[model samples]
Target chain A: MSSEVAVSKTGTRLRSPRHMLADSATLGPFLTLLVLFVLFSLFIPKFLSWRSVSGIVNAATPIGIVTIGVTLLMICGEFDLSVGSLVALGGYVFAMLLLAGAPPALAALLAVALPALFGLLNGLLLVWTGIPSFIVTLGTRSIYRGIVWLFSGGTLIQMLERPAVLALFNGRLDVLNELLPKGANFRTSLIWFLLAVLVFQYLLTRTTFGNHIFAAGGNAQAAAAQGVNVSRVKVISFAFSGALAGLTGILLFSQFRTVRVTTGAGMELSAIAAAVVGGTALNGGVGSIWGALIGVLLISMLRTGVILMDIPFIPADNFEAVVGATIVGAAVLNTWLGQGRAKR
Target chain B: MGRTQDHSEPLVRMEAIVKRFGTITALDGVDFEVEYQQVHALLGDNGAGKSTLIKILTGVYPPTEGRIYFEGRHVRFSSPRDARALGIETVYQDLALVDTMSITRNFFLGREIVRRLGPIPWLDMRAMNERTRSALRDIGIEIRAPHEKVGSLSGGERQSIAIGRAVHFGAKLLILDEPTSALSVAETRKVLSYIENAKARGLSVIFITHNVRHVHMVADAYTILRHGRKVGTYYRGELSERDIADLITGERER
Candidate 1:
C-alpha cells in the first residue's frame, strides 16, 4: 500500500479548488450585496442616509423572519407555498381579535398559532398521502387564501388602531438615538429578525433535532433505517414555517396599521428565491440558516436599489425579473459547485 | 419469555417464516438461525427470499406467518426501531448513511449522546468525536477527521463506519447486506477483516450476500436458501467450494 493514502496527522485535508468553489457558493451573495450597496450609495442621492438603510432593514424583517422557516423546511426537503396566505390570515386574525377587545399578547399568540395549524395540515397531508410537498402546499395556498377572503370579506381590515401593538412590533430602538442621533434609530423588527436568526441557527447547528433534519432531508430511507422519525421532522419544520409567516404578518400589520387582504401575496416565492440564492438546494439536506439570511438581505438590497435608481428601461415592478434571474443563476452556480464536490 | 443461560440455544431462531406481497409469496416456509458470537452467512441466488428473510428477522416487515425467537424469548418486532432497541442492527447495502453529514453525526444519527445542562439537551460533540475516532481506529481504519463529511470517504471506508457504529452501539446481532458487493479487491479484503474483527469482539453476525466467495472466508456457518426454502445448514469445513456453488444454483436437486 502507498504511504500517501494514509491518514494525515493533523486530520485536516488541504483545501482544494472544489472546496473553495463550494465556499464561494455560500459567500458569493455577500459580495453581490456589498457591490449593490456601494453602487446605490454612489449613484442615488440620499441613498446612504440612515432612513434609507433603516427602511431596507425594516422591509427585510418580515420576509427575513418567514425565510428562516422556509430555509429550515427546504433543508428538511419540503416547501410551504401557503406562507403568504398565512401572513395575511395572521394579521387579519390579530386585527379582528384586537377589535373584539382581546389583549395584544393574546391576539398575537392566536395569530401565530392559527397559521401554524395550516402548516401542520400541509405536513400531515404530505405524510399521510405520500404526495410531493410542492403539490400539497400548492393546494394549501388557495385554501388559506380563501380563508383570508372569508375572514376579511375581501376588504382590508383597518378597524383596530391599537398603539400598543405598533409600539411592541414596529417601534424604533430610540435608546440608541442618544449615540449617533440619526444613525442609531433602528427598527424593532430587525431585532426580532436577528433574534429569530440566532435562535434557529442554534437549533439547526447545536442540537440533535437539527442533525436529524439534515439526515432526514438528505436521505430519508437511510434516516428511517437508523430510527429517525422522518415524518415528525417534516411536520415540525412545516409548523415552524407557518408560525414564522404569522409573525411576519403581525410585524407587517403593525408597520402599516392595517391588515390588507393581499398582505403576503407572492412573498412565499420571494422567500424561496432568497433562500435558493443564498445557497439552499431545492432538493433539501444542504443549506444553512445564515446563508438564507444573507439571501434575504441580498434580495431586499437589490429591490431597494432598483426602486431608488432612475433607470428608464427597467420599471419598478420589473424588479421581480432580477430576482427570477438571480434564482436561475444561483442554481446554475450551485450545480457547478456540486459537480466539483462530486469529483472530490 | 424466560431468560435461560442455555449455551446450546441459538441467539436468533425463525421457523416457517412466510411473507406474501399482495399476490406473490416472497418467502414460503423458510427456517433460519444464528448462534451467539458466530458468523452465519445467508447465501442464495436473486429472488431466493434472502432479503425478505433478513427484513422479517430485522423487523423491517412482518412475516405473513412465522415466529421469531431472540435470546430464547419469543419476540415480534413492529418496526426497525423496535429491532434496534433490542440491540439488532442491519447495515444495508447502501450503508444507510447521510453523505452530506459529518462522520460523527452520521455515526450517532438516531442515537445521539447529549449533555443535559439546564433544560435543553445539547449535542455532546466532543464526546461524539472522540468516540467516532476510537471506533474507526478499533476497526483498523484511521479517518482524517471525525468532523469530515462521510461523502468524501471511499466505498469500503463508508461500510466500515456503518459496521463500527453498529458495534459501538452494542449490537448483539449485526446483519450486513452485501457489504463487499460494490468494493474493489483490496476494499473487499478490508471489509472481510471488519467482519472478522466484529466476530472476535463477541458479536453474532448475519452476513447476507449472493456472492458465496466473499462470506466463505470469515463465515463460521453457512445456511443456503433456494426459492424461499432452506436447502440445509453446514459447518465451515463441511462443504467444498463446488458443493456450495451447486447448492446456491439449486443443482443439488438434479
Candidate 2:
C-alpha cells in the first residue's frame, strides 16, 4: 500500500509544471527578458512608439552582431574580452588605410582580417600557456588597445567626408516600405544585420561546425573522447567573435562618422548584458540569436526610456552605472527565480 | 550468463594492466577478459581499481605497463575514438550531453550524418532524427519527439536516450560506469531492461557497479576486483546476490 501511494506521488510530481522546466537553467534569461518587457510596457509610455522600437533595434544591431559572435564563443565555454580592443583596432586600421588611398572594399576587408589575426593570437597563447581565457584576453586587450592608440594617435578619424565609405554605410534601400505603410524606409545596415543573423543561425542549426561548438563547450574531455577537435572549436569561436566585433567597429565608425582609440570602450559589458538578457547563460552551452536580439533590444529600450523620461537624478555618461546596475539586477533575479523553479 | 564461448575466441584481453596516479597505484597487474555476446559485471569497491581499468579500456589513460588485445590482435588505443573504432563505448554518470541540444543532435554529435555538396557539406537533420527516434523506440523508450531537448527528459528517459545512442553507434562492448548508482528504483529497472535489450542484440557489455543487485539482475558473469587486483571471475548462477555484495564490500574471500 505504501509502495502504491509512493508511486502515485512520484507520478504526480513528474507531471507537475515545476518538474517540466527543471531540466537546465538555460531558460532563466529568456523568462527574465519577457517579464522585464511586460513591466516596462505597463509603466513607460514612451516605450511603445514605432519610432522608439525602430530606434532600439538600430542601436541593437551593432551590439547584436558582436553578442551573437561572443555567445558562440561562450557556448564553447570561453571568453574573448579583447573584442572591444579589436573593435577599436579594426576601425582605426580601416580608417587609416582608407585615408592612405585604399579602396573602400579593401578597407572593410582589412578591418575583419586584422581582428581575426588578433583572435588567432589569443587562441595560440591560450592553448600554449593553458591559462584561463579571462587572463589571456586581459593581456591581449591592453596590447590591441595600445596598437589602436599608436595607429590612430588617439584622434577621431572623421570619415563623414569619405564618399565611397559613406555610400555603403549611409546608403538607404527602401524595401520595407512595400511591406509596411508609406514612408517606412529600410536602412542598408538592417539588411546587413539580418543577413548576418540568418547566416549565423544556419551555421548553428544546419552545419557540423555548430555541433562541434556545443560539444567542445558542454564537456571538452567527453568531446575529445567522442573524437571532436576541441582546440579548433575554441580557436575558431574566439577568433570569429573578435572578427564579428571588428565588423561592428567599422559599422560604429560609419554611424558616429568617426573612429578613435576608445571607439569600443565599455562595449563588451553592454554586449554581454545583451547576450545574457537575450537568453544566453553565463556558464555557456545554451543561447539563441532571437534571444540575443531581444536582449539588445531590451537594453536599447532601457536606455531610450531613461532618456525620454528625463530622469534627473543621474546625468549623462554616468547613466552607464544605472544601466549596468539594471542589467546585473536582471541577471541576479533571473538566476534566483530559475533556481527556485528547478528546485520545485 | 557465464562464458558463451562456442569457439576459442576472446573479444578483449588485458594482460598485466598497470596504472599509477603519482605515488598511488590505481591498478596493479590486473588481467581481465570479455568474451563476445555476454554481459560482464565488473565488481569492485570505491578504490578497487574499477575506474582505472575502465579508463584503460576506454583509452582515457594509458596503462603504465602491459598490453591489451582486441579480437586476438594487439591494440594500443591512444584516444577514446581509437577505442570506439575497435568497438568500446562508455556511459558515465554525467551522461556527457549538452542539455540544450535536441535528442537527435546529441545522439549523432561527433558522427553526424552529412550530405556533400561539391566541396561543402551539410548535416542531414532528417535522416539523423529518424534514426534517433527509431533507436529510442526500439529500447522501449517512446519519446514523443526527437526534436525535444535532452534536458527535458526524465532521469529514466535520459538513461534510455544515452543507451540508445550507444546502441545506434554500434559499440561492441559498452562500458557502463555506475549507471544506476543515483537512479530511483523504477529508473534502475528501466536501465536493467535496456541492458538486457543490448545483450539481446549480441553486444558485449561491461556493466561496472558495486551494486550486487544490479549485477544479479542483468549480468551473465562477474569479475570481482579488490585492492587493485582481480579477486575472481564467477558465473552468474553459481553465486547468490548477497555473496556478490560481500565480494564487493570486502566481507568475503574469492
Candidate 3:
C-alpha cells in the first residue's frame, strides 16, 4: 500500500507542467529555428534548396566549433575573449610549421597545444591573481593578436601547396554532394563539428568532470567545501576553450588555404552571442551543448534568410542588426521561460 | 548502537588549540572531544571561536598551536579534502549544495558513481538515482523523485538531504554548523530527529548551534565556549537548560 502511494505521487510530479518546461529548456530555441526555416522557405524562392542549406551549415562551421568552447567556458562561470585571436594564432602556427617542412600531423598537434597552453596561462593568471576572467582574457586577446601580427608580419600567409592532410579537416563531401540535388556543397568540417558536439555534450552530461563543472559554476564555495577542486576545474575549462579555438583556426585554414592576422577578428562576440541565444546562462552553471549547436544554426539561418529577403531598407552588409536583435530577443524569451519554470 | 564498544579512546580530541589571526586570538587553549556514537554540541555566542575551532577540525585552517587526534592517531589537514578523506564531513550553514542541480546530483556532488566505457567515464545516473532515493528514504525522507531540483525542497528537507548525504558517504565524524538556525520549529524538530538517527547509526556528530533548547534535546554531551575559552564539557543531565543558557552568556561561575 505504501509503495503504491509512493509510485502514484512520483507519477504526478513527473507529469507536472513545470517539470515538462524544465525538461524542455532547449525546446524554445529549436522551435524558433523550425519556425524561421519554414517562414524563410515560404517567402523566399530557392531558400529551401540543398545548396542554400549546405552553405549556411558550411559558413557556420568555424564559429560553430568556436562556440563549443565558449559555451563550456561560460557555463563554468568564465569567459575567453582571446579565442578570436587564438583562432588566428592557431592558423599562423599551423601554416608556419607546414611551411617549414614539418609533418602535417605534428603541426596540427602543436597548433592545438599552443593555444591550449595560452588558455592554461589565462586560467593560471585568473586563479593566482584573483582577477575576473573577463579582464584576464580581455588583456590576453590583445597580446595574442599582437603575436599573430608579428608572426605573419601583418601579411597574408597563403599556401600554394595544399597537403593531403588538409582534406581530412575540410575536404568536400563528394559522396554526399553527389547524392544530393545539383549545387549541393557539403564539407568534412560539418562532420567534425557534429562529432565535437556529440562528444562534448556527452562530457558535459555524463562525466564526473562535467558534474564538477556545473558544481563549480553553480556554487564555488559550496563545491569547494564538498572536496571539489574548483580552481583545477576552471583551469581545465580554460584549456578546453583554447584548444577548441585552435581547432577552429585549423578548420579555417583548411578551407581557405591561407592565414592572416585578421582571420578571426570580432568572432568572439559572435560565439558569445550564439551561446547566450542557445539558452546558456550568463552567470553560469545552466546550459546545454546541443542548445549551442542549435543557436549557431539559428543565427546562420537568420543571416541566410535576411540576404534572400533583401529588404529595401536593410542591406546585406547591415544584416548584423537583425542578428543582434535576435540574440537579445532569444535571451529574453529564455529568461522568461526559465522564470516560469522556477515559479511553478 | 552496539558499535560503541571501544569507549577507552574518544573518536576525536583537540588539545590546547590556540588559533591566532594576526593579533586576535580566535581560539585560546581550547580542548574539545567527541566519543563514538555521541552528539557533541559546541555552543557559543558571536565571535566565541566556535567557527574557528570547527574550521581547524575540518582542515580549513591550521591552528597556530595545537594538536588534533582522531581515532587515537595524530592527524593534520591541509584542506577540507584531506579531512574528508579521513571520513570527516561538514555540512555548512549554507549546506554546500547547488540549488540549481537535482537532488541526486547534489547528493553525490564530489563522489560520483561512474562506469568506464573504454577510457571514458560515464556517470551511472540510474544507479545513483536509485541509491540517492534509498539513502534519503533510509533516513526517513521520502520524496517525489530524485531528479527534482533541490531548490524546490523546503529548508528542512534540504537539511535532511545534506545530513543524509554525509551519513551515506561513510562519514565517521559529521560536523553540522548551525543546522537549525534558519529552520522553523517543525523543521527544527525534524532536524533534531535526524541528528538522533545519525547518533543511533553510530556516527559521532559535532552539532554547532546557539540554541540551548536544541542542544538539550539531542546532544549526548555538550561543550560551551566563552571568549575563546572552554567553559566546560558535560554529559546530559549534568546541566539543565537554564544552567546551559547561563554558562553560554557567562552568567554562571564555571
Candidate 4:
C-alpha cells in the first residue's frame, strides 16, 4: 500500500546524547576483560603460551557456540534453561551410537539430529503452550535428563576405538608446513565455532529475520504490528538455542570419550553466565558473540585458575554469588552508562 | 480549524465496528473514515473506546461485528501482521525501539537491507547508515547515525524515528495513537510538522487521541466517540471546539 513516498531530504540525522551510553555497554565488559587479560598475563607468566591459548580456545568451543545461540535468544528476549539437559541427551545418544557400532558420520549426524529434535520439541511446546520459556524449558529439561538417566541407568557410556568420530571431534586441517607460522589452519570444532559466530553475528545484524528477532524481543506488540512473525521467531530462537546446546553435547561426548548424563548437568548455568557476562541481557534484545566468548573464557580461566592456585576455592554456591554479583554489577554499570548517555 | 475533515474519497472506511470484552462492549457499532491524504482525528475520553477503535484498525483487536474496508475492499484482520501486510503501519506512544541497536537497525527492523555476493550476503552497514540518516532527515529529523543506539535519543527524537520509519515505508494508511501526548511543546510541534509532512506526501492518516486541542493543529476530520459509540463525524469547518467539548463530555446529542 506504499504510495511511493520520497525519502527524507533532511540534511542530517540527529542522534541523542543518550545513545552513546547503550553503545558503550558492550565496551565496558570488553575493556574489562582486556584489562584482566593484561593483568593476568603479568601475574601468571604462562598466560600467553600457545598451548594455554589453544586450551582456552578449545574449552571455549562448546560453551561459546551455545552462548552464541543464547545471545540470539537474549536478543529475542528468551532463555533456554533446557540446554544442559539437551546436552546430556545429545551426548548420550552420540555415545550410544558409537557403542552400538554406528559409523562416525552417522553417529555425528544422530548426535546433532536428536538434540535438534529435542530443541524442536522444546520449541513446539513453548509455542503451543504459550507458557513462558523459563517454565517450558524447565519442564523439558527434566524430561530430557530423566530419559537420559532412565535409559542409561545413570552410568556413562564408554566406547572403544572411536577413531573416525574422535578425529572429527579433535581434527585439524593442515597444509602441514607451508601455512604461516603454524602448520594447521584449523581445528574442527574450532572452525565450527568461528562459523557459528560469523553466521550468528550476520543473522543478528544483517538479515530481515534477525531484525524480526530484535523486534520481537524489543516489543512483541510493536513487532507484530510491523508484520513480524513473533511466534515463529520465538519458536526458532528456542529451537536454535536447544540445537546449539545439542552440538555442544556431541563435542562433550567426543572429548570425554564417554557419555554421562552429568556431562551437561551444569554447563547451562555456565553458558547462561557467559551470555550474561558478555552483555546479553537476561531480558534480551542486546548482546554480542565476542562478548559471550570473553565471558566464557573468563569463566573457564577463573575456574581453572582457582584449581591451579590450590586455593580451596569457594563453594559452588559462593561462586554463584560472585556470578550473581557480577550480573548486578554489569546491570548497574549498563544503567549508569545509559543514564550518562541520556545526559549527553 | 480545519483539523478533521478531508473532502476527498475515504482512504479507510470502518462501518459498525463492534468489539466485546467478556460481556462488555468495547466499541459499539462505530463508523469512521479517513480521506485520501487527510488526517482524521479519533477523539474520546478515557474508557470511551478510543484505544479499541485504534486497536481494531491497526489489527491488534479485531472487531466482533463490523467491517474494515480499505480502498473499497472489505478486510478483516486477525493480527497486526494482517494490517501491516495490507500497508497499515502504526507508531505507538512509547515508540518501541531497541536502545542497544543503532538507529538504522531500529528503522529497518523486520525489513532489512542486505549486500550479498552470490549466496553469502552481508548487511550493507554503510548504505543502511546513509539511508537511515537521510530517512530521518527527510522527516525533518537530521542528526544521528544509523548505528546510534535509540535508547540514548531524546523523547522527541525517538518519536521522530518511529514516525520516520512509518513514513519511509510509504504506507498509504498511517495510524498514530497519542503521538504528542507525552512530549514537551517543542517536541509536539516537531511531531506536528512531521504529520503535516506526511499529509503532504498524500498518506491517509488516523490520528487518535483524547486531546481535542491537538486536533485543531493537524487533523482534517473528527470522529468523536463517547461510551464506545460514534457521536458524530464532522468536518473541521463544520464544528467548533466548544461544540465537540460539549458533545464529548455530553452536551450536544445526535
Best by DockQ: 1
lDDT of 2 at B63: 95
DockQ of 4: 0.39
Q: Rank candidates, DockQ, best first.
A: 1, 3, 4, 2
Error of 2 at B54 (Å): 1.7
lDDT against the true structure, per candidate, is 0.85, 0.77, 0.88, 0.75
- Residue A180 Cα positional deviation in candidate 4, in Å, after optimal superposition: 11
lDDT of 3 at A65: 88
What's the TM-score of every candidate structure?
0.93, 0.89, 0.93, 0.87
- Per-residue lDDT tens digits for candidate 3, residues A1-344, read 11212335325443444345455557777888899899999999889999999999998888998999999988888988999999999999998999999999999999999999999999999999999999999999999999889878999989987788789888898878999989899998998899999989998989988898988887888888777899999999899889989999999999999989998998899999998888787888777798889989999998998898889888888988988998889788777766654554
Candidate 4, which CAPRI tier?
A: acceptable
Task: Quantify how close model 2 is to the true structure by its C-alpha RMSD in Å.
Answer: 4.3
Docking class of 1: medium
Selected candidate, larger DockQ, 2 vs 4: 4
Tens-digit lDDT track of model 1 for A1-344: 22223445665655755565564446666666788789889988878888778777777889998999999999999988989999999999888888888888999999999999888889999999999999999989998999899868998878545577777787776755455546656778888899999989889888989998999888898888888899999998999899999998889888787888888999889999989988888888888888888898888877777788856876888887888888999888877776655555
By how many angstroms RMSD does model 1 differ from the true structure? Answer: 3.1
Runs of candidate 3 exceeding 4 Å displacement: A1-19, A160-162, A337-344, B238-240, B252-254
Query: Candidate 1, after superposition: displacement of residue B32 in Å?
Result: 1.9
RMSD of each: 3.1, 4.3, 3.1, 5.6
Off by over 4 Å in 1: A1-9, A20-25, A31-49, A159-162, A181-185, B1-5, B21-23, B252-254
Proportion of native contacts found in each model?
A: 0.73, 0.38, 0.63, 0.43
